[model samples]
Target chain A: MKGYLGIDVGSVSTNLVFLDEEGRVREAIYLRTRGQPINALQEGLRQLAGRLPENTGILGVGATGSGRFLAGIIAGADVVKNEITSHAVAASTLVPGVQTILEIGGQDSKIIILRNGVVTDFAMNTVCAAGTGSFLDQQAARLNIPIEEFGQLALQSTAPVRIAGRCAVFAESDMIHKQQMGYSLPDILAGLCEALVRNYLNNVGKGKEILPPVVFQGGVAANAGMRRAFEQALGWKVYVPPHYDVMGAVGAALLAREKMAGGGSTRFRGFGVADTNFKAGGFTCENCPNLCEVVEITCEGEAVARWGDRCGRWSGSLGYQDEEIRNAV
Target chain B: MKVTFPHMGHMWICLSAMLEYLGVNVVVPPPTSKRTLTLGARHAPEFACLPLKLNLGNFMEAAEQGADTILMAGGCGPCRFGYYAQVEHAILEDLGYNYRLVVLEPPRKHIGELLSKIKYITGHNSWREVIKGIYFGYQKARMVDDLEKQAHFLRPREVQRGSTDRAFKRALQEVIAARDPQDLPKVREKVRRIMGAVAVKPRPVLRVGIVGEIFTLLEPFVNYDLERKLGYLGVETDRSIYLSEWINDHLFLGLVRGQRSRKEACRAAAPYLNHFVGGHGQETVGSAVIYARQGYDGVIQLLPFTCMPEIVAHSVLPGISNELGIPVLSITVDEQSGEAGLVTRLEAFVDLLARRKGVVVQ
Candidate 1:
């Protein structure tokens, strides 16, 4: 049996997924990024390794997310794509009629509007965190509730309090004020869910027409409370696919599968990537005013991959052997 | 010695006032014109955004008019505005212009650092005087912005057909001549009174909201006075951001990352736009939502074209328009954009908006 592997290493979370040749998900692993993407990817791969059949050979590998470039190099991926394309691809594949995608991950959030399976419009919030999963994590910690139980608490609410969802500061103060006002934990949690959904709608969903069948994915989609809140706010049912948490990875896997569907072999370095001694380093290119900070990866003192060169100058330099370098000089 | 910065709309009124308090001569760059655009376009990279090219042109023009030093703010982010100083410096150097570029790294924590830098630039040794100058400068800028807002609503009415130039010239002259912040209300009232006196003609107009990098939107030479050009085609304009917001975003709220700054913009734009669409892109979407809700015929989103944040916003705008039932035309301004082609798009967009609104164009 042959399978494809996909990894998405984000600022807030890392995900790994495996898909069979039939585009069916065989196994998926989702883990918290916790500011250590390298460790998260390693742990996730370990978990995925245990689940795979011993005889199953990994056919191809793909990586996506904000840290896709780094993760791609680390995973020795055959293909790499941005979150927009990856998410859109996954959502469209799952819900063939998916017209809009509301994907809120750990640290960032995005809204993709699709028309006839094509991404017509999209927005991403990388700088702000008010609507992302980390905000909810902080609120969960503040409330002394486990993140896993947050959705259940939200579901238990009788009356959801209205907290300021405009910003995290105001939301914090507002959450405190609600607590002082004698709101139950469940009500507060529910209110937070509503407020976050409201913030997402206003910020990322602004000006864009969100059409149905709207597919909500990303790590945040794992929270049933958020799904309910979105449904209530938008006055429509929001679909959460079975593999919501690792949709980015699944999408990347799907893309890799599609790209490498032909008899051609994948450029993936294989599972032995775990044993490889690799070091990633960066240096600023002084070639032009662009001053691109090119990051290069060296495996056993041999340069294997170079990226972040906006002008491809560093990549071009690395491709040449010592003879080419001498001749050029 | 007088220190001058490149003029961006009513920016000079505040900067000049600040410079004046330091006993420095403030030589404001001449108002943006065809020459400014020509000069900027001639020297700027073909792929560079219109604003960058225009700002570089503005600096060159300012240097030619006897300015020796330029003060600019620094940013640290994915936004192209962060790299403006470095690129502008290189462009100026390549052009053989000699000038000192004093970049004020955005205040990471307290406003005190920024105040001290302002003091340093102005040569105001006294903190008390520097504080006074800053307070007064801020007051003047707020007042100017207030007048400018009124002018946006009034410009179409007060000016005759193709007379936006005359009305703006008159209003700017009156604004420049105002003695103080207190004098602004009277100036505004005068402008309003004049607008009321002019005959209101019903014309097909497309209202465009210019949002993106602050420099590109306000600096006419960069965007080729895109707003003015759109206005020339009988389009109403609404731009939600200014230098003040940029200052506040960098100097103040930027301390917290993730959702904190995102919420800050949403709070700021709440009076105008009641919801968050996401990112600072929400600012543009919020304004467009309000514009559409308030019966604006059509919406145009203007960005530096390749600006990541705005691109994110642009991606979502189609859905926004689709949902709101508003026709939105997005124009990305890079150096390569031709004025004639942009004008034609504006013409077509206006025509479409008019057709949608059942307004007949003459």
Candidate 2:
């Protein structure tokens, strides 16, 4: 079997997807990053390798999300794209003619507007992460409800109470106040969902013309309450794609396939990279006043990649003989 | 008196040259860095824009270097910048830093006061020599702006990465070194030769207009080196404000030179924003319209977080974007902005622009 591999190493969750030659998803894996992207990426690749048949070939690899550059170097991706473009590509492919895409991931949320199957405009939440998936996770834990059951509980709400949703801190305090007022758990949960939806629409979705065939994806898309809240706010039906949680990965896989169509060899280091010992460390360069924090990644105790220096002193110091280092730089 | 001023792009070159030519002891604060921002942000009011914080940081760093006086520009408008000097001075006094702040306000009818301040800073330079120094400094600013314009044009087209930037640095150093008025033309020739040495690929490039608050537009440290980033993404950037232009418009030089005035921008913005909203807000709106009329690929609004004027402009920009059929992106920079996040947004914006132009970007 031959396919392209995509890895999206986001802040909270790392997802991997494999797409076969026909651009169909073959495997999907999601795991918690837990502040250690390297570990999560290797674990995902290992799991994916185990699930694949013997002699499976990865024709190309792509990486996306906040930790994309790190994932690209580790996975030897042929293409590295930002999450916005990746998500747009995924939504447009999965839900054809998706005019508007609302993606709420672990740490950030973004609104992508498409026209005639092309990305026309897009915006990501700026200076605030109040209404993302991580906030919901924290709220669920605070209420002593399993995160998986949070959406179901909200669905059972009879009268959803309104909560402040301007800032995450303010929202949390507002929720505490409502809880102390003896509001039912389900009602409060549903209210929190509505508040977040309002915030998302006002902030990230500001000035965006959201015509329907709207596709909602990302980790928070699994929350039925959020979906319902968005539908009610827009007064239109919102479609959550089947692989909504891993759409970034899916987009990366599709991008990898597109790149491979040019007839070139894949730069993939292979699934065997799962067994490689990868170590990452950082050091502050005091040579200048910038004091850039540089991160270096080592594979089998040899320096494989270095980045994060604004002046390029450390990033350019390493040899670029390796294709991975060349592309990463 | 050892004089220091905040950095705003290459304007310092002209300022330091003018002061040094008048035999004034000038101290240039260390190049803006994270430490400078951290020092400034630590003491600055949390809600103040990034420029004020950076200005505070500049003064502190200069104070450590034995600077006894700070040179700052002043303005009067609805913008918070009118109060920055006073606020920064009070903050420094609270921190027990002994320094005198000499602000040069716009000389509408107060030309005498402006001259007296300049005379005090220059210590004992004759009036004739002072005027000569001022003219020389203005010319130097124009030259620097010209050099920067060329760099922006060549950055995207340069065959080798970093070639244009390296050449720009060399040319700028030459401009700074050519202090004597007679040596100006020699510096100009050298700048042209140096910039010309950068081989260009001669490819069609996407043009982007940058307009917003003066500080954010002029200071790369606050805006995450936006011009360079756009250059790397193969986009040519045209900035709406330059030091020489600001000086020309405010110092009555524009009338003397018969140059294009801010009134033109105001007229262009009249369709969308009829009234002055303060700072460069009107100019930001006008520049987007100008760029759109010129058939540019996109317009990017760079504003410091909480900038009152640009915030007003930001609200009105989407309408201009939709009406003009040009993509507009508003980016706010503050202490909390992450480089990775900025890069991602920039790449996505460039991707959007490229796709709209039917150009395939890897």
Candidate 3:
């Protein structure tokens, strides 16, 4: 096997990365999901497969992110892991001895505190999007500055304003208020970063032991403004991996490599999956008063996976062999 | 009069047992769901906790099905739960439901008062029979709790995945069918044997201690069947709150002058939170310390969004979570909590725990 394929289908972005047997990233691709994860995934995979060397044997596949289960069934992933694990693994693999990880994506932010390459504690944004990529993007668009230049502009600010960052709506309105008060755009952007960090610390990062050697990655990590704010707040240097945005996919591929090492046959249905017709539909299960909305995924007009059922009526009907997992303590 | 009560997880099982033992016609509100929540939210005041809305729904549905009297446990703490009965009653009255709302408050310092309240519900039971009925109800409550504990312990390790759940349902049905206390021993033995019969190949799993408000912790529908979700994720879930534990500590122990788990929880929580903040807030903090000290993997705190007592608990939990070196995931649930979003968080938390323990997660 020459390489392994990893797909990470998130709410805002779909990432695909191919890692060589040596666990080195060979190709990395990122595509905006825009509320259509399947299309984003298919386009990303097709581009990824087309770019790869001809006849490169793919041994195994892994899927992660919010849509791991869905992407796993679609891609025939050998290992379906969560984004936290994927991010932590990729962070650890990239920056050895990483003690903490801060990931802010489009819709959520997470803080994973690690001890000796193991994720010890983690907290994700719950019902809050204040310290996320989308919020930052919105702020940038509102300022009429390209998001790519917003960070650099913040770096030029001599006096940063303080904006409320506990809620996205309040933060946005606060930024507008700061603007009306004649604060420089760069200063407001810088203030936004500080507020975001404050909100993240007060919420998800609360009660966590964040040690040094912190690795910050995700779409938001591209912002030098946020990076500087983090340094000023925590007084610690934050390292961004080379393939930051695609780290989840990289971790997935690495995990796939680890699992395939156990000598099990690859579950990779091949790049042919990119061309497969996938349709998902949901129905309310009236078997009980709970009225669980069962989601069914069909490929080529045949049901391949079913979930969202509180009971095992549909999930148990199909016999899909998953990896042997440790008993939950 | 035909009596019913809003759902509180498995409390219905024990409450039903109590009513039946007292020889009253009992109608359980249909198991809580979207319909129940909608009806409750429609009638309940906005800003009320999820439990209040759920209970209201339960009562209305049960009333629609012919129940004329509603029995509910009332509280009198810093928590807003105590006044729920009065407000719910008014709402029901405004909704034009012809039903009686009987709020059962703790007798506090008197066992006689508690017994009298029971007599009031039973209508005409002799003192001796009331005692007998009380004894039977307590036994069933305990049995259900025990059976559930075993199910929690065994569900993740069951070789056939959901076979343990199937066996548990069967065992619960058998236990629920017991008409006499004597029948309990037989039922308990059968349940033990059946749940024990499931094959196990347990290596190790994350031991998650679930703590927080009593309502969301107990009512699966309210919290999206969190225990079941965790169990299927291959985690051992031990809830710190239960109806039996509540009755034992808050009611029985208070009146009978006996000790239960509350003292120990309070003791454990002393360093982090010395005073009770009302409701289960202190318990939630203390339970995390207790669970952490017990070598558990992590703790998950589930609370209704905007719950005061739980907010208090949430404030103090981080200190203990840090001091005790236990990872705590605080999940605040409301009516709009999406199941998929919950699953992702749970999966991530479980993955974090497994990775922490050096498990080769797939």
Candidate 4:
């Protein structure tokens, strides 16, 4: 059996998905990043190795995430894409009519406004943690509730309290105040859920024409409480796809499938990538005052890729080695 | 040789003082007056930011006055400041300026490369002297900054009773005449004494944070002297585009790795705001939060029209205001931005904040 593998290593989570030749997800693994993506990818690959058919040939491999550049080096990615493009493609593929996507991941949150399956406007909140899964995890911990049970607690709330959802500090104080007033844990949890949803809508969704067929993905979508909150706030049905957590990887695999079907040869390094020795080294380029700190990845002393350059100087310098290095594998 | 340094708000004053200490003749383009804007607007690319245009104008004016060298700083980041030096160098060269442009890239993973650039620019072969020059330069910059911040609070009230510009000019002249750091205290004392004598006003004023596109925020011509205009309307401004903040964020933050100062910035801004609203929205949130807490009437966030980071901040600010119960007005200005429209918005935002705070406009 021939198949494709996709890997997404974000700051918060690492996801790996396998798709058959027809672009159907055969299996997917989602693992917490826990500060190290290398180990997570290895473990994810080990699980996939167990699930795949014996003697299955991995036809193509693609990677995307904040760590896409790093993952591309590790997985020998045939294609690499930014999270925005990857998420939009995945959501569009799942809903076919997805006009808006609200993807709140473990560390970052992004709102993508789409018109006719094309992304028109998008904003990413990478610098703050207020509307992210990490924030929810922290709140769940503060409430002494198991993170897994948070959504269930929210679901049980008959009347959720209204807490200030703007800043995390105010939200925490408000949550504590409600708790002091003898509000039920479920009500507080639901309020926290609503606060997060309201914060996301007010911040990222501001002035945006967020139409229907809205798809919510990322790790946050796993929470039923958040989904309910979003539905209640927007007055529209929000769809949570079955494979919400690993949509980025799934989208990468889908993109690879489309590219491969276009008659162009796949640049995938194949399953043997797991066996390759890759090393990354960085050096400062003092060619001009814009001293670009360039990072280079080498496979057995041959430079495979170079990035982290501000100017295209270093990358442009290595343009000659592209075909030679790609053909070497 | 006479040299010119791009004005990074009050940092240019420090740079000038440092340059003077080095025995280098420093020519600062006059402090962002109308003529500076007229010259910048006439010469700058329409899409370029007001700060860049203003600085370019300053540099041009200085160059025309026989300044033979230009010193620019460099960085590597998502912020366009990293590329400003290279682009400005090309633009200046295109204008047929005969001056040599010296760009000093911040020392990143490599210290040796940074030292080389420093040696090249200062024309001082000794590393110790280069270090000392920077040390003294920083001291002078901080002193200048300290005085300028005081001026922001004092200027509007002094001007409210008339002769505000006169008071500021006299204070700056005293600061400029100081011989060294020790003399700064006396200079500051004199300025304070002068400001103390100026009549003070008792009405509440709107406080706005001018942020986004470093050039636009600092260059008066680009924003059409928005700060002065705001002050004229009894508005107090808190701008977050200080060179110190930029240096702390871009350079020092990285040196102390794993600390996540961006998160810290958000947390610090939390009392005033919640979550990152995008771009420098955190700073906008910080300013707004601080303004509201400090009893400032309103917060105005300014960005060059079409600037990506400010746009992101603008989208997030309305929600911030909604939550904080503080009013925030977002102003995006480009070449075509009308002075009349900006004045109208500023007047409305101030009135709104005053009404919300129950401050009677006397």
lDDT of each: 0.70, 0.89, 0.84, 0.69
Residues B218-261 of candidate 2 have per-residue lDDT tens digits of 98888888998898778999999988888889885475465556
The TM-score leader among the candidates is 2
Q: Give the lDDT of residue B131 in candidate 1.
A: 60
Runs in model 2 with CA error above 4 Å?
A319-329, B255-260
What is the two-chain DockQ of model 4? 0.01
| Window of ten residues with lowest summed lDDT in model 3 chain A | A320-329
Give the interface RMSD of each candidate.
18.1, 2.6, 3.8, 22.0
**Model 4 regions lying over 4 Å from their true place:** A280-293, A300-303, A312-329, B7-362
Q: Candidates' TM-scores?
A: 0.53, 0.97, 0.94, 0.52
Sort by DockQ, best first: 2, 3, 1, 4
Query: How is the predicted docking of candidate 3 categorized under the CAPRI scheme?
Result: medium
Question: Candidate 1 residues A171-241, lDDT tens each?
Answer: 99999998998989889889989999999898878777887898999888988899999999998899999
lDDT of 1 at A100: 89
For candidate 3 chain B, the 10 contiguous residues with the lowest summed lDDT are B251-260
By descending TM-score, how would the candidates be arranged?
2, 3, 1, 4
Q: Can you list each candidate's DockQ?
A: 0.02, 0.62, 0.53, 0.01
- Candidate 2 has a DockQ of 0.62
lDDT for B23 in candidate 4 is 64
Distance from true location, Cα of B14 in model 4, Å: 24
Q: Model 1: per-residue lDDT, tens digit, B169-231?
A: 566677667655566678777765554454456545555565555656666655656665555
